[model samples]
Target: MKARASPSIIRRSFILPVLLMLAFILPFMFLRVAYLVLESSTLCSSPLDCMRLRLFGGSDSSLIMKMERKVQSSRWRESIYWHLASHGVPKNLHCLHLKLAEEYAVNASARSSLPSPEYMSRLTDSSFDHVVLLTDNVLAASVVISSTVKNSGNPGKLVFHVVTDKKTYSPMHSWFAMNIVASAVVEVKGLHQYDWSHEVNIGVKEMLEIHRLIWSHKYKYMKGEDFEFLVDHERDLEFLSPRFISLLNHLRIYIPELFPDLNKIVFLDDDVVVQRDLSSLWHLDLNGKIVGAVVDSFCGDGCCPGRKYKDYFNFSDPVISADFRPDRCGWLYGMNVFDLEAWRKTNITRTYHRWLKFNLDSGLELWNPGTLPPALIAFDGLVHDIDPSWHVAGLGYRYPQVSLQTLKAAAVIHFSGPAKPWLEIGIPELRSLWTRHVNFSNKFFTKCRIEE
Candidate 1:
């Protein structure tokens, strides 16, 4: 107290403490600034609600968790399936495995077996009564074409325009060329030969080709407990099939564009078998409508057009909600009679494009799976209801529950849902109907392991 400290010493002491405090505070301040800058730069790729929750939001977001779990589940299931299939634990390899398309082309016997694809170009002339079948499933195509022609009372009148993608063109052509259906003229053409679908249209095909690719956060329309429910649920069992079967399955949508010169044609799906004359379908009057299709199923009163197509789309968007009614009855797509002249008059293609584009831009808010919903919308007012007996659906999903009487009565039976008659999953008893059409005696059949 008696001796006062020097000014330099006092100043030195104060400076030391201040410097120490800054040293401790500066690092923390820098760390906080860095964190804020990093956070502000974070951007979400998709506008989906899940993206927002995952990016800037909370871990408690049930939607995010559900998506994660669902993805994990699919991966898990796929791995288990692969493991079993690799070990030959699977009873039917058809469902579990797929041979490379080139493999079919490689077999000498298979290549030698098909009928000439030379008649493929004749579709443009409209001189013949054509039954158009567009597919890449050579096996299924063979069965369907053979069955259709075999069941027809007049096989010579039947002309099958089997259109496929470029990669499949040669093999498909070969298959048909070798296994010539008696009196039925079969034509095979690649997608490249058809100049109808534009570049943008090709993109649609590509998108479908890659749909199973990282579903990820692209589709995030759900929230809360509902998200959890969808984790285990496959909305439509057919949703997964399109990824592998994209090229063939979606070709049905562009039938009018594919065959520009044809006025009227009968379109058959690859999964279908004809037990009666489909020529009768061509004879039925469409009443000026562009499409003739059978109703999917009867409703409470057993009326036609019972299935509501609108249910497949997301009506939450103002664009979709304003344009479509969720209660409208939907039609099926297996065997359709397309009136090309009438179709050209309508904006079915344009409508299909517009809706398809909107759905693409809107993150596929239209249909959850497959190409049917777009066709349903595109052919909305243009569908003519044929007799229900002409096409029998639900054979795939519920074969046992199907009335044997009804199945027998059907002119055409569609393995519409998923359990295709050719797959191991198909009902053995029901499969005999489709198997009868396969040429097991053909060398291609034995070489390709296309077992009966």
Candidate 2:
């Protein structure tokens, strides 16, 4: 101070402080910039409202590219350009894998590879707000995807892109435009693998597949979740009465306890339709029973060992010999209502597993392990018997001589014989019913039904 500080010393002190600050801040700035670039490049948003759009489902590189091109095209440009410019989507949307960890045979594999809540948190930290699951594997993928989509619906928007395999292209054509309006398209290579090993009987692999579908969809309800499990046999299902929707809604309110926190399902066989509102069936009480089935007297007597008169209901009825009085428990055959929780609690899977083991051990061949009489007798609880007013059960049109009065009263007619209405013979009433339900003009829906 006494010598008067040199200008060089003052300048050196200021420069040194400035350099130290820059060194500390520069790396952080660089890192932030890198993160921004990566997010912007990878994220994508819809052309329309960013709040409404979500991308999800199983997709390959080709399908993804195609979707990207579509979004970039002039048709979608106005709706999407701003989003693209802002790098809005990838930054705001989360991608979820539909594949299950257990199926892949790896420990914590789903946690490590598939997107979890934690992954979603980290992604959202950067800006992502929505989740979409893409998948070709229907059962595994859809189950997982639906769970995530529903759960994430509150915190962020959720969507599912059900990219059917190439073989199913024609079947989904009519719905394509509608699909595009809602979500992007993904073309998968093939349908999920179908397992035939656990089939109940020879040539009933299709039936076994249907059973699998029932279990897969109902598991959520059994686990006490609110979900609408629509168990359509296939896309070919045509509802004769448009009023079916109202019927389902009525069932939800009036018979709430029947299904227990799940959407009451309508299990339609291919050959039936409703001419009037089905609300009556939905409101019908099942007491505490878990399932409802149409009573059929013609169930193959020889098929059920328990159906024989020797297995009489009252073993001690001295006046009624075992050979004279059979346990007429009224079998729940064809078109049935399943109480998801009740069925789960009964351990149907374990029962089915035990049945399979018994059959294998005894070298017995049984077709349709779900043959109602046996299942009803074997199951722990009672099943409610619905009037034939809802279900007309028989060989489809083969019994043309049978009364249509029965058919008219029936909410559902089961074509349970060799000749199907689609074959143009069995039940003329059924053919008429099918025609009434389906619009022949829609080639896509028609084709899907035939293929299925």
Best by TM-score: 1
TM-score, structure 1 vs. true = 0.68
Please give, for residues 161-273, the per-residue lDDT of candidate 2 as tens digits. 23334333222222322222222122221223222234323423333443333333333333474223223211111111121222221122122222233433333332334
How does each model score on TM-score? 0.68, 0.38
Could you tell me which 10 consecutive residues in candidate 2 have the lowest summed lDDT? 232-241
Whole-model lDDT for model 1 versus the true structure?
A: 0.66
lDDT of 1 at 239: 46
Clashes of each: 7, 20
Show where candidate 1 strays beyond 4 Å: 1-122, 125-127, 195-232, 243-245, 296-306, 318-327, 398-401
* Candidate 2 residue spans exceeding 4 A from truth: 1-263, 296-332, 365-374, 377-380, 395-397, 443-452
Query: Best candidate, lDDT-wise?
Result: 1
Cα lDDT, all candidates: 0.66, 0.37
